[model samples]
Each structure stands twice: as structure tokens, then as C-alpha cells.
Target: MTIQNSHNTLPLDPAQPERQARDEGQGPMPPQAPTPTQPLAQPTPQAQVVPQPIAYQPQPAAAPSNGVALTAMILGIVGAVAGFWAVVPITGYFSAAFGFPLAVAAVICGHIGRARSKRVGGVGRIQALVGFLLGYVSIAVMVIASAAWTVFLFIGSL
Candidate 1:
């Protein structure tokens, strides 16, 4: 077969007669006629959607107590004040005696404070312990000095 070429058109391949026919404004080839051959297949089944229920959970909250902290602070202050008084000269002995009780109270208050603070949150454990220690030490020294004074007086009288 021979290829035809126009002045403004490119040459077409003779081997592609079907393409050349369509390019020349010919309609596309008619669809092939169907034949009664086999039976049609059926569609497959789809899955069903279902909703799920969620379980509810309760949470426990933290409970804080401020009383212990307040008591601790007050006791610590009292211990410090008493301990300070005990450090003086004549009044020192009486102060130390008074400070002993205050120190004991401070220690108890400090323990309570630490427990409450752990539950709530506060500061002053160091101060409470120090006050308690100082008060107790002063009380011990006072007792020893008093005993020594008594013994000395008795010996001097003899």
C-alpha cells in the first residue's frame, strides 16, 4: 500500500490502515455484537456494622490537711523562743526547763507536719527538729549543773 502526503499534512504509515481511516473522519468501528453464551454471576454479601459500649472509671483525688502544718510552725516558733530564753544567764535555767516541754511539743508537731505536708505539702521540718534538739540538750545540761551545784554546797558545808 502507498502513503499519501498533502502539502500541510504529515505522511501516514500505510501499515496502519485502521488509524489512517479514523484520521480521515471515519467513525470508530462499531462494537462487536453480543452472543448468548454463558450465565451471569451474582454479587457477594457485605458485612454489617455494630456499635460498642465503653466502660466508665472513677479517679481518686488527693486530700490535703493544713492544720498539721500550722501546728508545726507554731510549735517550732515556741521552741525557738524558749530555747533563746534558756541561753540567757539566771533566767537561762528556767528557760531551759520551759524549753524542754516546748521542744518535745515541737518534735511531735514536726512529725505530724511532715505526714500532713506529704499529703498536702509544706516546709519547716529542719527548724522543728533543730528546736527540739536544742531544747533537750539545754535541759540535760541544766540538770547536770544543778546536781553539781547541790553536791558542791553540801561538801562546802561539811
Candidate 2:
């Protein structure tokens, strides 16, 4: 019927006298005797602990969009074109300067790309093969040009 001034208990409606008001840290107190002046004995209240929720985080993406074989293909094409020019009469030195290293890199990248593609079930087998072929052709051209230059020098010295 009235608010408990001392215990900070919840307010009660006079219509529901049977309902008991629970304290912040105390459990239900036994009902008081018919005499309103007497106090009832109360049991010790148990403290309930609520567990906190853990935070969720997401990881970064792993796979690349375009294939490595595509890169090998382009490098092989450029290197082969450069090395082909080195086989010419006057452009050997100039082309070799850039072509030799590029051709070697192309060959290495092509093989690595092919192996990686195979492992990942990639659809760049043909591209890798073409790139590997171009790299081999470039290296062969460079070798031939070098051998011919050496032979010409040997013959001219005589």
C-alpha cells in the first residue's frame, strides 16, 4: 500500500497486498505477522553476475583477382621482342643491355607463374606455356648472337 522509505524498495499497489517488494541486494523477506508494528526475518540475498560479450572482428582478403600467368605473359612478350632485335647486325650491344636481364627474368617468372597456377587450379595454363616459349626463344637468340660475335672476332684476328 505504501513505499518502503528505509529499504529503497519498489512501490506496491494497495489492491495487491500479497505481492512482496524485493530489495536491491536482499531476497524475499518472510511475511510479517498480523501485527503491523513487528518486523519479519529476512534471509541473505545472493549476488548474480552477468557475463560480458566478446567482440567480433573480421580478417583481410587473401587471394589476388588477376592471375600471375598474365604478368608472365606480358613480360615474356616484351623481353622476346627486345632480344629478337639483339640478333640484328648493329643493335646487338644496345639490345643486350636491356634484353638479357629481361629475358632471364621472363623465364624465371614464367616457370614460377606456371607452377603457382597449377597448384591453385588457375585457368592460365596456355598463357603460361606461351610465356615460357617466348622466354626460351629470347634466351636462345641472345646465345646465338653471342656465339656468332665470338666467332667473327676470332676469324677477324687471324
**Model 2, 1-158: lDDT tens per residue?**
56666767554663334444343435555654545555666768988788989788687877643366777788789888888887777787578667877777777777888788777667677777777788889889988887787688789899
Off by more than 4 A, model 2: 1-66
Q: Write the per-residue lDDT of candidate 1 for residues 95-123, one digit (tens) a residue.
A: 66776676667667666666655554455
Instruction: Return the TM-score for candidate 2, rounded to 2 decimals.
Output: 0.54
> Model 1: runs farther than 4 Å from truth?
1-63, 121-158
Give the TM-score of each candidate.
0.39, 0.54
What is the C-alpha local distance difference test score of each model? 0.59, 0.73
